[model samples]
Target: MKEIYSNTQRAILWLGDYSDTAVPSHPNAVLSRGEVKAAFGIAEDLAADRHHDTPEDREIAEGYRALDALLKVPWWQRIWTVQEALLPKHAVLRYGDTEMPFARFWKAFDHYFAQSYRECCGEYWLDFTDTSSNVISCLQTAIDYRRLLSHDQGLVFSVLISTFRGRLATDPRDKIFGLSGLAGTLVADYSLQPKDVFMRAIRTTITDSGSLAPLLRTPEPDRAKDLPTWAPDCCAKLGPEAQHSWDMVWFGLFAAFDAAMGTKAAMLNPSAGPVLPLQGLLVDEIYEVVVHGICRDRDEFCAMARRWQHTTETVAKRNHGVYPRGGTYKDAFWRTMVGDMILHEFDAQGTGQSRRAKASDEANCRMLWNPNGDHSMGVPFSRDRQFFTTRAGLIGIGNPGPKVGDAIYVLLGGRVPFILRPTPKKQDGATLLEYVSPAYVHGIMDGEVMKEKREPSWVHLI
Candidate 1:
């Protein structure tokens, strides 16, 4: 196992080296016909954008035209033409890949980016390189490759390296140490200092934690009114052990974060005063709230669902696309909410409500939380609130309140049902009915609701 893992890691390191060496200092040396075409395609796409009509746009347009002309030339002449076009004498040489000319070597680099790497490198290997099974695992990998190499982490890198090396080599935890070593080497190669690399890693971790912390911190107005009404009665049905396991998994993530902070802090500058230890503070607060405030009450599960909904809504409001919104927010929101909701709902309601109400709630919650409706407007909070209660009730998660579904399940007990119609009788035997879950049903409903709400759209809303 050690040999196999070591060989795999070595291969990845070699690939990194190969990728680095392939990049050329010059923008255009000799590009393949396909490379020229790809560049031209990208340029044309940019030119079509609304902002491309300015004087700057025209200048860019002229460059693209020149490149397009070179692309049209015969293969041999085309190569020479691009080289001449990107020569040092040309004022635009400074632009490199942008407007500058490149020699044949640089052109090859551009071509490499355009190719499908899966075909050349093998998809299985790439998956292994990128798979992240835990928060710490992902963080450590990102720190090595993305943060240390791409950003700053000088102090953090040194601390991580020192700590990792000091660990007992034969210990089970040495895998983590080995991973840290790899990260440190990658960062050093990328010209990032230890402090810069680790700081960025810490920042990235904090940025992710920020989304969940706010939800955890929110308080329920009256415990009596909320807990019994929202708590799933199916706990007795699922058995105590299963429920306890579920709670352990949920809270364990928080505990892991707390445990990781001390190691993370060691990477920081000791002399630096705390302006805002935002990441550390947020992690501590989330754990406190979850363990003390939410976990103690029967309504705590419902509270968690409500918190997720609230946080999703807040993030969505901030990101309603006058400016382009990346898919990260949606991805993060869905993964965190869906995983927690499903597990918690299972704990609360057992297997009985798992298929329908829980599923339906997931759909409706996604719909209500969607910031982008076809109507090009935000959904009203009033309508969203109604959907929350209705959906939660249907799913068997909880009753709707301002705080409901924010932390627990976005839909609580409200899942839409798909009842099957009976099939016509067959000659061979009796007819039967089958039910299927369609993917777009919830999305369509959410779109309709957004259209109904018709709130004003704005840039920089978030």
Candidate 2:
């Protein structure tokens, strides 16, 4: 499968059971191999005819059922198959006795996905309960995979990894090794030991690319103790709670710089390993770890609302009236974390109880607000509380682990400010900072601080 990345030659995709392959059975398999093959034939036919402009309701439901069954095959979940299927010149997916063009399959899947979203969003008149939840999940994974392959041809190494974080691999090392070819020049050595691959991939990508895009990823909870705080454990799962679409939250930063800072040329000696030599200006030091909960019940929602208000007041006081105009700073923060599209039911009062409302009072934020799960407007809090406010009074939400004394800085070419924890070592006799992660400082992320004439300086990240 790794060979597929280097081979630009044409390839064919065989989706049916390969008797010699030792891949494990996926737990979500609900249909026999033969049954899946048969379903593929029906699905292919349905997809071809699904575009009839005025189809009956019963006809559309039948199409959804057939398409759902075909998507459940184990082939979609494997990590290795991702590059193999996607990089091929022209591909056809075959299940048992049926075959169809991969492109046609996706076009059909897109149609069903649109219908599903509308029904789930209640924009369509039909009820959404008829479709199975498993089908919805399968379609989403497939779509995400397609999107990952379709875009991001020029993105740095770590950003590419973030694109496919949820994919499963039997060997953890394969997760990094698998993308060696796709990430190309960003990875200096794909031959490194599996355990060492992630470190090399991360260090090389950061220095070579010069962009702090890697720090934007949400780290896996069980991150290896030896791994630097700046590097993400790409091998582990992001869990269901992680907002996979955080790129949108940091879009404000990109809007200012138009790109992340990082060059393909090396800034330090290649012989020097592990530690990175970065030059950035120190913007703020974290003085407090703000705690806030998900909007579970009315009280939590009100609390979150108050936090928004407090952040606005803090921003206005510190920045001297420079803040989001027309919309409150709370709205801007919400747009930074979530997107701008507010769910009509949540914001529109007197609209009766929304069917999308969740019953649980626990701190499960993803479900309560993020019904679409796309990180659009109204995302639930990933954790019960998140970190915010450095000693400099810079208030913004960040990854869960930053603490007091950690420093926030704006690296040249970095779209957003990064939070770094000081490490106990020096790189070639110079002080170094251990990169914590990128942050969402409400006023600074969008070039507001640069407007105040702050000069750039060196800040090493260990």
Candidate 3:
């Protein structure tokens, strides 16, 4: 596994590492704006949404079907290619007989998105419409999966696990072991069992750097299995709730813990592996579970939004209107639901053009109370999923599976409080409390619950 990860034995040439001779200085090889636009034009003509009128359009459309065919290939969705392409010092992408520098391809791709965005906003033309928007968007989204590779190279293990979870892998274990090189200090020992590999990787990470932020980005724990809720199964795909965990700032979550005390030590018994102990405060119990109704269309979404509004209103009224006159709490709720969206005041306020109104505006038009001058900012809500409110009335976004009995705890070095369900076990005539599932509680993610001066307790995960 280590040798496969190291890429020491593979002699096959990957997509990005092609020689300079392959990518000649020909005009066809150059990724120019005009070339991209022409390619997009061909894509637009081939799309079923719009009708092609001219003979020139039909002729150009036929010429680019090969390009469309190439784009549709699952090559981009392959996991092995991603690691192989990213690890090399110099890389270039090749399509059929043509070759182009990988850096230039990325630049062109970014430019295409920007161009389409500009067109959408009426920057280029007030009536501009992109027919090939879907094609460009898909490729851009794929590129985004690798964005962390360049941004923060240190957290490569977490980054790879987060980004490429959707991609295809032949072996389930390859999902965890393939990108070990990018993990900086977090390397997997091939000797460990495949199941143990993932757990060890996460444990090693927590042991090396006494922070639990990595645990937050993990997949939901299997309810029937004994696997630690804190340990993510890299083999499984990350759901919508766990998707945004990668984007969170680690230091910000651990700021309070770091400020008060130095880094917490990990209690690991190397001989006896599965029992890793952590000390943290038990924050609160989940009394209510609110599953947002599935909204397939406009009317359904609006109705759900109204119901959500009413729920928030009732909750606020019971608390004697803890929010100010502006209904900021209601706005915060919607923002949390949307999670990490950048909205503008005018954009939220409908333009009265029904066709032009965005889906976000259609669902909810409220804005967060921003004292700062900036109009656009990413909200901290986990977004695109259902969340729950704890007994203490703290808002949280975590696994939708945890029920009323599950308890939330803020571990000493953890960035987010985990949702642990207390199971009654009669062991040696004494009832024991065994905690399950280390979940992400939204509001208390930044260790605000820890500042309450509550005593921390040790919970053993069996």
Among the numbered candidates, top TM-score falls to 2
Where model 2 places Cα greater than 4 Å from the true spot, the runs are 1-10, 17-72, 120-156, 186-191, 241-266, 293-302, 314-387, 424-430, 446-455
Residue 241 in candidate 3, Cα distance off native in Å: 14
| Candidate 3 per-residue lDDT over residues 34-113, each given as its tens digit | 33444445444323222333434554444344344334345555666666655554465553334555544544555434
Total clashing pairs for each candidate: 58, 12, 4
Model 2 misses residue 140 by how many Å? 6.0
What are the models' TM-scores? Answer: 0.19, 0.69, 0.64
For model 1, the stretches where C-alpha displacement exceeds 4 angstroms are 1-30, 33-38, 41-45, 48-269, 272-462
**Which has the better TM-score: candidate 1, or candidate 2?**
2
Is 1 or 3 the stronger prediction by lDDT? 3
lDDT of 1 by residue, 304-350 (tens): 44565554455455556111222344443443333222322212111
lDDT of each: 0.26, 0.52, 0.48
Off by over 4 Å in 3: 1-68, 71-74, 113-155, 218-226, 237-267, 270-272, 323-335, 338-384, 425-446
